[model samples]
Target: MSANIEKLQQVISSYFGTSEPIDESTVAADIDGWDSLAHASLMIRVEEEFDVQFPMEAIWKLKNVGEMASLIAKLREGA
Candidate 1:
């Protein structure tokens, strides 16, 4: 896995309290702790870790881990 994806998985595992490895196809709906509140918290953690702010539109559109990683890469590239 790429470094970004690995870091993303780490954040996700920490947020969701899951030891199971997450992959690109992992969606919010696939996790037990991925509720609305957890989603918000996860976003915050991701922003803090990556030092990037996600626009509201892009935030809501993220459906899976792969998409999140892609968005993070795009945002970092633009930075």
Candidate 2:
């Protein structure tokens, strides 16, 4: 896996307190304790970790772990 994806998995695991490994196909809806509140918290954590800010309009468009990782990578590249 790419470093970004690995870091994203770590963030997701830490934020959601999941012992299982997260992959690109992992969906927020499928994870335990991944409700709206947790999703917000996870997003904040990801932004902080990557030092990239996601626009509000784009936040809600994220569907799965792969999408989140891709966005992070794109932001980092543009930075």
Per-residue lDDT tens digits for candidate 1, residues 19-56, read: 87799999888888898777888999999999999998
| Pairs in steric clash, model 1 | none
Candidate 2 — which pairs collide? none
lDDT of 1 at 3: 84
Quote model 2's TM-score: 0.92
**Candidate with best lDDT:** 1
Candidate 2: stretches off by over 4 Å? none
**Model 2, 1-79: lDDT tens per residue?**
8898899888888887788868898887778999887788788989999999998988888888898889988998999
**Residue 42 miss distance in model 2 (angstroms):** 0.9
- Against the true structure, what is each candidate's TM-score? 0.93, 0.92
What overall lDDT goes with each candidate model?
0.90, 0.87
